[model samples]
Target: MADAREPVVVIGLGRFGTALALELAERGHEVLAVDRSDARVQALSGQLTQVVAADSTDIDALRQLGVQDFYRAVVAIGSELEPSILTTSLLVELEIEDIWAKAVSDHHGRILRRIGAHHVVFPEHEMGERVAHLLSGQLLDYMPIDTDFALAKIRPPHSAVGVPLAESRLRSRHGVTAVAVKREDGSFTYAGQDTVLSHDDTILIVGREADIERLVTRS
Candidate 1:
């Protein structure tokens, strides 16, 4: 976990980078926003702690901006593979400790990891899959975990509502694990073996995609 008190540096001021920097600033974390373009740095100057116009791939520039002092850094260069990889490499060499990079493809992700990025994300692919799951109408919301499992928000089955979890046979029948239960009034309770389901309850489940599909289809 990132320490909120430490200043965070965000390299690149594209949509993802700008959004992340603004959100971190709003959460009370000091943020240093950097971009190669004047427009991007200027657009976010008033909202973040500070904004700098510089090329992140230049080691001297990073040092000049004191980027190495921050433990948390996000390389948000999208599509530009060369700059993104170079920035990640520079951060790693500086031993910044926590490096997160956005990658457009598996190869890009692999390169980032090989160069020591702490975390790599594919925002477009992830969002596309999440939207697909919601479009299926069976899932209220969904997030992918690895390639096999997911955390899914779904409506409790009509047959299972008003019944205790022990009697639901969800685990035995559908091979899914329930994580939490959300009530209509917005209160939440950890799902347990004896918890009773309500008509307005939502359940968060983790399971295999095939099994999750079967569970929802059966419900």
Candidate 2:
């Protein structure tokens, strides 16, 4: 397993890159933020482990910054497609084990993947879809695990509130599995066949996105 404190290099100082860098730092990871603009580098100088004003596409600059030593890197140059692809390609060439790139469109994402980006993300598109899902249902939280699978948090439905998992027939009726439950006392526990849910409890269910949506709509 990768060390939890492994340093991460974030190229670009766009909104996505800045947010990712800050969040990583908040989670106790050492983040090296790089950007071409001096102002952008200075803005995060006090927050991240290190901040540099240098072009990521420059192999020499990257090597000088010790980016080759970092196991993970993120190319977040949105709106600047060429730089993003070039940065990702350089990381791949440097044998960075994990390379995540932000792509503005399908074509951009395809190129990033083809050039060896381990992960390609469309943050705007994903956030929009997530908000749409939350707006259309009573789901308290919705997290997509993959193309079809998702984990949903919701208040227990009337039919499930007073029954144990074995008797609730949730899987049989809704095609969803109750993975965990959060009691009224604000504690969470794994849900089992013998676990009974209270009306005020919250449940985390896992299933196909369609199935979870169906269950969410019912509640």
| TM-score of each model, paired residue for residue | 0.93, 0.94
Model 1 lDDT on a 0 to 1 scale: 0.90
**What does the lDDT read for residue 14 in candidate 2?**
83
Residue 129, candidate 1: how far off, in angstroms? 0.7
Clashing pairs in 2: none
Q: Could you give candidate 2's per-residue lDDT for residues 1-219 as a string of tens digits? A: 469788899999889999999999999998999999999888888888689999888999999999999999999898989999999999998999999999999999999999999999999987887788889868888887887898888988778877788899999999999999998878778999999888889999999989888877787
- Report residue 175 deviation for candidate 1 (angstroms): 1.7
Error of 2 at 202 (Å): 1.0
Can you write out model 1's per-residue Cα lDDT over 123-157, one digit (the tens) per residue? Answer: 88999989988898999989999788888999887
Identify the runs in model 1 with alpha carbons over 4 angstroms from their true place. Answer: 1-4
